[model samples]
Target chain A: MGELRRYFDDIELGEEYESPGRTVTEADIVIFAGLSGDYNVLHTDAEIMKQSIFGERIAHGLLGLAIQAGLFTRATQAYATLAFVGLRWKFKGPIKIGDTIRLRAKVIGKKETPKPDRGLVTVQRSVLNQRGEVVQEGETDLMIERRPRP
Target chain B: MTGSYFEDVPLEHVEETPGLTITSAHVAIYLGLTRELAADGGAVPDVLPLCFTTGLGWRVPKPPLVVLAFMGLDWQVLRSVRVGDTIMSRSRVVTKRPMRDAGVVVEEREVVDQRGEVVQRGRFTYLVAKRTKETRA
Candidate 1:
């Protein structure tokens, strides 16, 4: 883990964090396909893909986002994480197998929930491929607990 | 199955998907692929991953060979979903816009638990190819 347990108070707006990168592989796609049950031809049917514009198979957009989430969790140990509130994301480009990707995340906004012990943190996440191009970008909100009363 | 073309999608009728019972095995497989460890020793993670819900939505019925590409997503997790929860999904076209050879189709989707409470909702936009002149005629 990159950071110790992060509480609501520990998060600072505008602060950024970069995550380690991972390469997408064929096996990853197959496993994700089974887990998600998304057998879209674009993701599964190689023969059909040959005639498509992309000219090859592409990873599912959600799979890329899910991997980004894993990278976030691995980069920070937020013991106070309450729940994943929401997200608005765009898939800027197709991520083919063998493309390496990482996350550039920053705390963009925050708000206090009605519950005194918890708050919402909004993060701007950019998923970048090996070539430094942003393949996906989004903002995700997470509900986190404040530090326990000392 | 032939995917829905831009002109084939019905914007009003919400399509429902078969219900699926979330299991520990599903959670484990997802965690393994993502290399994430459960925060606790429960069968499912404390908060179910949003991708799981999105996956359920993808099972909704659609026309064949018409979906060009997935464009974007906007989603919200309204409540926590735990292991053994039976969930179903419904989707309806929210918007559609035409382009030169393709069109954009946006669908509003909701995932509901056995209690019939919506646990997740989102909009999925896709670029769908229009029927060729031959097919349209």
Candidate 2:
């Protein structure tokens, strides 16, 4: 486990964190489909997708990104995160159902802001399947609060 | 150019949807799925609106793209989305590159609140299926 209540001052460039694994389930895909209203055959039609190249239903691309958000917060040092300001992401491969995925993130860049109480940090994030293949990868920018001065 | 198929989508075409109010129920389903609790419990989860950007694509009046796959996204959150805020998405087709049987369509997507302030903006690249001889028939 990492430090709790981590502040901007505590983040170090090049530091990495890995999250606990989570298996993508049928419910996850179905729930995401309803939530997003994206009933693409690739995700919803099993028989139809069975004839496609993938041969099975795959999770929504944004669903994986949403899961990555949860895994990031769970794995990283508990920062006083303020806002998720930016994301540069790519869908490199398909994430099929029953695939267990985890996040591997590294602090790639950091910058100070005009405000004294907060700063920005950029983390290179990767969502890897159980086989260690990177299904999705990107960089996310987060605004974090600074440590309080007594 | 009248249809929404890969080949039919014209560049610079803009599609906008009516406002959809963000309710606590939507946030609850999202939070239940992601299990991500905002650092400030009272605040909406940062990624909720980002996910909604894709969902809002369904609300457009124009026919949907015959998309084969989602390629990627380059997104920036310009402002926070509060509970009860009504947000709408505006997507403009920026580029279209044809492959063999499919095409890559890139669109500049924006989520604006009721006040018409941009809450989030992004570039979405989608792999769309072009109408072939079989599909055209």
TM-score of chain B of each: 0.83, 0.91
The TM-score between candidate 2 and the true structure equals: 0.94
C-alpha lDDT of candidate 1 relative to the true structure: 0.81
The digit string of per-residue lDDT tens for model 2 on B1-137 reads 12368867878977888777888888889888987765544466767776777777777777778777888999998888888898888988999999998899999999899998998998999999888776682
Assess each model's interface with DockQ, reporting 2 decimals per model: 0.61, 0.74
Give every prediction's interface RMSD.
2.4, 1.2
Residue-level error in angstroms, candidate 2, position A14: 1.1
| Local accuracy of candidate 1 as per-residue lDDT tens digits, A79-100 | 4788778899999998999999
Model 1 spans > 4 angstroms off: A1-3, B43-65, B134-137
Candidate 2 error regions (>4 Å): A1-3, B1-3
TM-score for chain A, prediction 2: 0.94
Positional deviation of residue A109's Cα in model 2 after best superposition, in angstroms:
0.8
What lDDT does each candidate get?
A: 0.81, 0.86
